[model samples]
Target: MNTNQKTIICFCEDITKEEILKAIEQGYTTANEIKRHLRAGMGECQGRGCMPQIMKLISQKTGKPREEILPPTDRAPIKPVPLGVMGKISKGNQKGV
Candidate 1:
């Protein structure tokens, strides 16, 4: 855990600043690349929270415009879903399919 890294940024995966920076240094500049390299954005929340900050860091370090960077993958269940909610949703929709 690097002291300079925000402990909460990658809370779901516990990825550290050192790891993310190492990925950036290794040419994984995009958010998706970083996610793939470190599994930073591959957790339950699907990175809806940490992605913006990650992108900002990557842009600042690589001197790339934030807009030029491709957005992170929008995996299903953008928000955290409780198990009960998931079960209810599944049951509710099963009749249609």
Candidate 2:
């Protein structure tokens, strides 16, 4: 186990810096590859919480600009639905969707 586990990079996914580094060391250099390997930016925060730092790490490791290191596949953030809300929403949107 890596002692640096507490050094969390993706708090939403509980991903550690060591895990990201290991993924990078194992040739998962690109943002998508790193996402697939270690799930850094696939958390509830939708990469907002951790992608900056992850990109920074990648930039530092490979001498790439942080702006050049793209994040994982972008998606809408997850949100909690109240009870029965999803059913109502889907039912209302069925014709439109």
- Compare the candidates by lDDT and give the number of the best one: 1
Q: RMSD per prediction, one decimal?
A: 3.6, 3.8
Number of clashes found in candidate 2: 0
Off by over 4 Å in 1: 1-8, 80-97
lDDT (tens digit, per residue) of candidate 2 on 1-97: 8663379889978898888888888888888888777877776667778888888888888888888898777763255456597678777858864
Candidate number achieving the greatest TM-score relative to the actual structure: 2
Cα error, residue 86 of model 1, in Å, equals 5.7
TM-score of each: 0.72, 0.73
- The local lDDT score (0 to 100) that residue 76 gets in candidate 1 is 62
Residue 15, candidate 2: Cα error in Å is 1.4
Candidate 2 — which pairs collide?
A: none
